[model samples]
Target: MPSASTRPVAIKIDDATRDRVKRLAEARHRTPHWLMRQAIEEYVDREEKREAFRQDTLKAWNEYQETGLHGTADEVEAWLASWGTDDESPAPEWHK
Candidate 1:
């Protein structure tokens, strides 16, 4: 019996796409269901990360607009370049 937490969900795909999935699944020794599940899971994970990044960017933009305080592009680039180096420096100070 399937686990209580697991339930079936149906999705319709064109015949061509369904055939392609079956072929790929056969080659990879996986079920069509597994392939679709993996695709959805990875897609969700990627989209979630993208959404988070977008939100963070918007927040940073709003904060900059409100405070008018920010580090110079060159300062930020230099700090980024120093990453993983022995002399990694602290982040630049924000200034008005």
Candidate 2:
């Protein structure tokens, strides 16, 4: 992340929450600004990952719809169950 060309954004908070944030910041020995910035960054990171997963799910669904090809739930479960052992099974093949 670049510190240059950064802008500050202001948000309104309730007095109670503001006080709580202030106390928490004091206890953590960090400024409120740093705390909020860290929180926003973490939230954005988590939301981005969630969005990517959603996109992958949609793509998978669309492909399945178009080709009418997919593995059965039982097959997927069996494949997943074989995760790390002496005789791990191969992945279930997709079929129409």
Q: Candidate 2 residues 1-96, lDDT tens each? A: 436688989999999999998999999999999888888888998999999999999999999999999999999999889889777999999999
Which 10-residue span in candidate 2 carries the lowest summed lDDT?
Answer: 1-10
lDDT of each: 0.94, 0.92
TM-score of 2: 0.89
- Model 1: which residue pairs collide? none
Residue 36 lDDT (model 2): 85
Q: Model 1 lDDT vs. the true structure?
A: 0.94
lDDT of each residue in 1-96, candidate 1, tens digit only? 234697789999999999999999999999999999988888988999999999999999999999999999999999999999999999999999
For all predicted structures, in order, the TM-scores are 0.91, 0.89
Query: Could you report the Cα RMSD, in angstroms, for every candidate shown?
Result: 2.8, 1.5
Best by lDDT: 1
